[model samples]
Target: MANSANALPETGFLRLPQIVGNPHANPPIPAIVPVCRSAWWLGVREGRYPKPVKLGPRTTAWRIEDIRALIASL
Candidate 1:
């Protein structure tokens, strides 16, 4: 999972396992993309990073808020 903007390393915060682990606790990119693709086709998928929302022209991003909330709910 892509780290939240608040969790970026350039923010000068400690790189602890717990915090980083929070996002990766789900799965890495290798496992996530396949499901994300399927979810994109199914319309029931959620929590995909870097492809959250569709911007105009040619852009996309995973709504960080959605992924975080989904994680929290889980």
Candidate 2:
């Protein structure tokens, strides 16, 4: 069976893992794009990736719509 971890939802936000993935987990969370967290952040800083929204004091996430547009551009 294919790993469903890479699958994205139609809407809502995505966390770092749900974007870059956590493949080492027991279920092996898949990645929509294979990238290191540091590089991802760098891309974000460089405007190559989507901007994150501050959900809380320590929470940050990206919108699925933004992510979809990014994937389309890629």
Candidate 3:
């Protein structure tokens, strides 16, 4: 009998390794870097991506999964 490991589906998004290399992930940062600001905003306006989360006093970030889905759909 032969054993094989099934390929896992992309479950979460992550930050591009260029900036951070495999740090502990909660919401999967993103394998690729973030998209442009205007583009992201447009995506939100189009209801393609979910609203961003408040990270700091004023900073915000979109759900990585949402971003990935948006790109895929586009």
Error of 1 at 48 (Å): 12
Q: Write down the worst ten-residue block by lDDT for model 2.
A: 1-10
Total backbone clashes of candidate 1, pairs 3 or more residues apart or in separate chains: 6
- Cα lDDT, model 2, residue 34: 81
Ranking by lDDT: 2, 3, 1
1-74, model 1: which lDDT tens digit per residue? 33343353332222122222334455532332224444443543442322344565565444545444544443
Supply candidate 1's per-residue lDDT for 48: 37
Please list the residue runs of candidate 2 whose C-alpha ends up more than 4 Å from where it truly belongs after superposition: 1-6
- Any runs in candidate 3 off by more than 4 Å, and if so which? 1-36
- TM-score of candidate 3 versus the correct structure, residues matched by position: 0.41
lDDT of 2 by residue, 1-74 (tens): 12332366778998999888898988987788789999999999999999999999999999988888888777
Mind giving the per-residue lDDT tens digits that candidate 3 earns over 4-67? 0112134433323311223456654332324554665686689765766676785665555554
TM-score of each: 0.36, 0.87, 0.41
Quote model 1's TM-score.
Answer: 0.36
